[model samples]
Target: MKNIKASMLAISLAFLFIACSGKVQTNKIPNETKYYLPKGVKTSDKVALDSKELQSYSLALEKFFKRNVKADEEKKQDIYQTGIERGYFQ
Candidate 1:
């Protein structure tokens, strides 16, 4: 009985660990998943990117984008260059 209980406890712990492990789902963004935009960016209307104001807006967007992207996934130089080209990072 003691052996069975120990085995069960170990299995339970293993299951819990696996359940709580870091698994970033890179599949697809659900339609319900809304992105949090800055106060200046209007959610409804299309607004032109003001070069002066773009810095703040870009920073906020970069933060949000970075949150989902894993560090390991950002291993290549292309990713860094693309971000720079797209004006995500300065």
Candidate 2:
């Protein structure tokens, strides 16, 4: 009984909030999801990136792209190997 009342109140509040906003919602979404700012907030000079920005981006990413990782072979020690060697398998 208590849960039903609480849910009905919540739904009514949500409908009231939506009714207060008079703006029409659209289904279309922008192809570019962002503009250098956090949360994709709109800015004036964020239309497109030129050659200078591209050059700076490449320079910044050069070190990260050049990294190489080498892994050495570790001995294959299974779980049963330890128990058998310690005379606990019996």
> Which candidate tops lDDT?
1
Per-model CA lDDT versus the true structure = 0.82, 0.78
| lDDT score, candidate 1, position 50 | 81
lDDT per residue for candidate 1 within 1-90, as digits (tens), equals 999999999999999999899689888766776866788975657768788688988999998887745665665567779899899997
**Estimated TM-score per prediction?**
0.29, 0.25
In TM-score terms, which candidate is top? Answer: 1
Taking every candidate in turn, the Cα RMSD to the unseen true structure, in Å, is 18.1, 11.6
Per-residue lDDT over 1-90 for candidate 2, one digit per residue giving the tens place of the 0 to 100 score:
999999999999999999898677577665686644587675586578799999999988996776553322245557798789889979
Candidate 2 structure, TM-score to reference: 0.25
Clashing pairs in 2: none
Clashes of 2: 0
Q: Estimate the overall C-alpha local distance difference test score of candidate 1.
A: 0.82
Worst 10 residues of 2 by lDDT: 67-76
Model 1 spans > 4 angstroms off: 27-90
lDDT of 2 at 48: 83
Off by over 4 Å in 2: 24-90
